[model samples]
Target: MQVQPLDIVVVGGGAFGAASALELAERGHHVTVLDRTASPHPDASSTDISKMIRMDYGADVFYHELAEASLDVWEAWNADWPRALYHPEGFLVLSAREAEPGSFEFESERVLRERGYDPQHFDAEHLRSVWPVWNADRYPEGYVSPRGGWAESGAVVARLLKLGRGAGAGFVAGSFASLLEDGSRVSGVRYVAEDKSVRTLKADRVIVATGAWTPVLLPWLSDVLKPVAQPVVHYGVDDASRWQSPVFPPFAADMAGSGWYGFPALDDGRIKLGHHADGCVVDPEHRGTVSEDHLDLARVFLAESLPELADAPVVGTRVCLYSDSFDGDLWIGEDPERSGLIVAAGGSGHGFKFTPMIGKLVADTIERRENPWLHRFAWRSLAEPRQEAARMQH
Candidate 1:
């Protein structure tokens, strides 16, 4: 338990903010979530039709464990809710190489087998038996995990926001104006409301989970927290149901090399394909438009992978913002300079999957609990270069 009850103001009511608010409020803290838009902001990274929910993180055991546990929670959420948000359609990992060293697919299959999860490898002959859409000549080998799929990300955010509010957590929607501080100690924040009226809200502790906007809002941390824009393309398919049938699941094509991954068709018959590359550095505030080069790249990928979608018209596109840290790990701890401030914004694109566990860590951090993950996430500095441990890093 915390030493005393805290008045916590969580900035950015997306995945991190809503989860933190719910956890903190459940732990008896007076929590309020301040979002720039409605709690589930459409522009927010969390507001998507679907996101991959796989327990595969290559050789990164920590994240492997995290996702494995999270999958269970997502299943539990489906059981608890009347309408299911999670889709256990399975995840297909197409590898260009056949179990090569340092390969993402090889590492993921190795780890899953070690952990006693049955992940099946499929060569060309085996691949043709299960996957109807798989290009045998293009992808000689791959693996399938039945426990993985995608989730209704935006709907999940809305459900979590509702849960947090029901647990006595207040939510205020408007853009964040500025920090309310007293000599390096942040007391709260000043925000501009929907009516253009300015209001000052006080808190014992301020947690900034504002995603890619974190660096722009707090300029001092700009070097470490960079806002990168990743391209997302949604295509309207005529036979959407057939695209995601049991034979054709959600998959990544030569994930590490091409960074090409896609989801099954949504209820609206739209299929979303997103790349996991390093992405372009962009200002989060003015980022909505995707470049022509990205669209060209998408067409090229579909031509090579799915010939059927070679000339498919693009229905939607978004330059989704990712709050990337210097290293590819999450940053969730107190600011060294500020007395009552906590920094918890770095998602690095693989964050939304950990929605089940992140809030508990935030709550535990505030209570000063000794958690093993704290060692990796604590405030620190290092010169090591960014490493790609997740299955896809282009």
Candidate 2:
């Protein structure tokens, strides 16, 4: 229904893309969102039932602050829409009692304290008292955050897509072919629609939020962004009451060691669980099917660490793809080789929580707005590998 050249063309309709389209459209830019699948449809990161979000990432101060801001945004939007987009069940970081004071959990507690945010540290007995259903003996200590939880990504993506559509942004189901380039500047995108017809949409600016598909579209940046496949599983709580849940926070297994993680019981009678670190390197198109072994790996960790819900039966499984940058941080800025093209991907695994601010940053970059955080995450800055980034202390 739009006639003139669009102000921005966004490739990929996942959370980042939808959020980008929503923000740009809200800014009065005629926007077009192109995706092979429908918005919030399967295969997109945003549609996966839930994505764990919290402010206890340990050492990543920028991400920690951004997460806090994002929580406020999610809460406000949930209230405004009167919808359950975010399930604010809070989060827990589990670790050993004497596991060095400088570890990520310890540093996170320090950071939270400095910011006037209290993260309660509990011992085995305290953990038992707090969560009787969980096995306190598995870990000596745990840090509980009253202000973190999981977001129903699919629902949020659906809401944003709807809002964007209502705001005059066009959503077309198609496969993004390539960037329409005039030398170094990107003009628009060519896509094959659902009916197999190829159409070209022209725009002044292009934002690529293809998630795991970022490197494929921009082959030149293959070394910068590596799409990784992360498998997540959901287990049904056989006896919900058997676990003295205590509003079981979104938990991360041994913040020092990348292992188990899970959510509180949802209204749908399923709890989400996954690994915070380990995942297979897989391609977006030819990814492996979620299998029983994947589910077992998640279950085994939860059982050993948090014995309360270990015996739960597997309910469902999903694969989460992370566009990992060389430094394991996010890449959100203009491409070095292309003008008028803003590349925003490289989630690694923890990008979902900051979708709102990321959308704002991508919009700002497209509009040439000055922002400190956006500047820090630019393409040029990411040229150097962040080895310390992998050992996040926030």
Candidate 3:
């Protein structure tokens, strides 16, 4: 089935939009990426110092497989890009108690083994010997997957935008206002340009990949999509070498129970930590600062888990917003009611790791291609909200 190249307007130039633009343009479609800023918007979730790039999805084999596929591309990108942004140091999953059935750490290791990957299981003694920073008593058992690590998120987005442009995708700086509709079909988008002038972009298809702003821009999705703000903080350590790789790697500290996870120190000696539990619902336009309660919680967790970092100076704090879906699965596909409107949102806080694969997944959706992974992200009716397996239930 031969299809004609369509003129597509992708709203929001975050990971989803930028990647989709690159893939779509490469496939010969006319793509124009409209974003709030030039590239890597400061407030966008995709614009971060570092994000975990792991294939540990607990018992969810679907995401595990998707992440496995993405990891291959991530490695390829490292080879193709001018400089490597993804650092495959490894990921350590820790548990306070011994690994048991149904636990996130247990399931993740079990799944990895089932999929033919060797994860090194360790007891507290082994962990203490390898990563001395951890409180051995607090984390008695866990495993480390040598294949997982972290990516410089903002840099990855910038690279994607550059590649997309080279592939013939155009970029427009503007704030999305509304969809321009012709009858029941979305024919274009109306946005406020950077110069304060109102403008319109006509397209054969419109992809709304605006992240947390999805429900706000498209009110009909409010029931299913929500904007959630999670707290993230960076601590400055005196000796960064002690916190870096081979000694310390990206880690989840009893994450399923405590919602605490952190990365090894950056070159400048700052360690990043975030909570992956239920966040407060917020309006993207008026998202407030990280709550004092959240900060207090982080302090307590550090005091118990990593005493060395408990008193470290706070370098930065942010309220990271996530576009949460009723179910944690991503939303990607055409609208059932609107003919030309497609949505590529619902990152739900774990989308950045799959950056390498999202574009092709979205492109397949747009072209109505038969992709095995497409069904997991397709638009559907709302249901009881279920967090992704790796996320903590608070």
Candidate 4:
């Protein structure tokens, strides 16, 4: 079976676009990636200091399997890249109550054990002895899995773009205006160039990987895809050593219940914390500042979970926008109504960790290749929004 290489254009240069461009170009396609800004767009969700890398999806075995596969590639990237971007220190899944059935902590541990991985269970006493920074009494049941950790997300995106360019994918800076169509088939893209001039790039196929802006670009999908904004805050710590790995790894503090999670301190002593709950709908162009209510909630959570960080000076803050679908699962398949058009979006806040696998997934979808995971992400009718298992209920 001889497949012809076609000219392809990918919109967005974040994790999905960069990964897709790299994969498509490597597969012999003439690929071009267009973005409003350069790679690692400052406002893009993928442009963050750190993102958790864990296979703990509670009872969702599908995501757990995908994450496990992604982790193997993350390790391989760490070994092959110019510098290590992924830190495999470990991940602590802390629960405020006992590991009861149907709980995120319990299901994650049970699934890990069932798959032959030994996640170390911990109690109040163990937390006090091993990770003294945590309020032992607040987190009574938890587990630490050595298989997961965090990654420098922005750096990873940059690396992927660089790799994509090196693999013969063209990079262009422009703001996408609309999909150019020849009748019912998408022919290419019309964009506003850096100099404010209109430009058009023709392609045999077009992949729109524009994260939170997906719904905005394709208004027809507005009902199924939305832009939701989540808050992320960074606090400066006086003692970085106490908050670094081997002491305090990346962790979820009753995440499914409280939506609170944080990473270990960076070299400059900044600890990044974020909430993964039901965020308010937002316009991608006008993503507002983090609300006072969210900061107040963070303060309260810290006061009870990590007392030392309760009043730590706020170093930075940002509203990370997610391309949320009706269901939390990603959308990556050709548009049924439009020939030569494919979409790859719906990050939903948990997509960065799967960067390594996203490219292959997008490539598979583009080629109509037989992949086991493609069916789950294909375009379909909207249903009741069933978010990921680890997402918190507000």
Clashes of each: 0, 6, 0, 0
What stretches of model 4 exceed 4 Å from their correct place?
383-394
Name the runs in model 3 displaced over 4 angstroms: 383-394
**What shift in Å separates residue 28 of candidate 2 from its native position after superposition?**
0.9
Model 1, 1-394: lDDT tens digits are: 4268899999998888888899898888999999977779988999998888888888888888888888888899999987989889888889876769667888888899999989877897788667756667788998897688888999999999899999999988778888899998999999999999999889999999999999899888888889998989999888777777476678888888888999888767798999988877788878768789889988988887788788878999988988888777788998889988887877888888888877887888888887777666677665554464463541
Candidate 2 total steric clashes: 6
Report how far residue 371 has shifted in candidate 2, in Å. Answer: 1.0
Per-residue lDDT of model 2, residues 1-394, tens digit only: 3333348888888888888888888888899888887777688766777787788756668767878888889888878885777877767787855547668777787778888987787888888887766677777887787787788888888888898898889987888898899998889999898889989989899888998889888888787787777777777875554432465666776755766666776665688777656566677888776777766676677667767567777778777777877776778988778898888887777778888787788877877777777855788545554554532311
Go through the candidates in order and give the C-alpha RMSD of each one to the true structure.
1.7, 3.1, 1.7, 1.6
lDDT of 4 by residue, 104-203 (tens): 8899899999999999998999999999889999988799986989999999999999999999999999999999998999999999999999999999
| TM-score of candidate 1 versus the correct structure, residues matched by position | 0.96
- Report the C-alpha displacement of residue 275, candidate 4, in angstroms: 0.8
Q: List the candidates' TM-scores in order.
A: 0.96, 0.92, 0.97, 0.97
- The residue-by-residue lDDT of candidate 3 on 1-394, one tens digit each, is 6769999999999999999999999999999999988978999989989999999888888888999999999999999999999999889999989878998889989999999999999999998888878889899898998698999999999999999999999999999999999999999999999999999999999999999999999999998889999889999998899899988899999887888999999989989999988887999978899788888999999999898888998999988899988788888889999989999998888888888898998888888889999877777776644554353321
Pairs with backbone N, CA or C atoms under 3 Å apart (clashes), candidate 3: none
* Residue 375 lDDT in candidate 3: 77
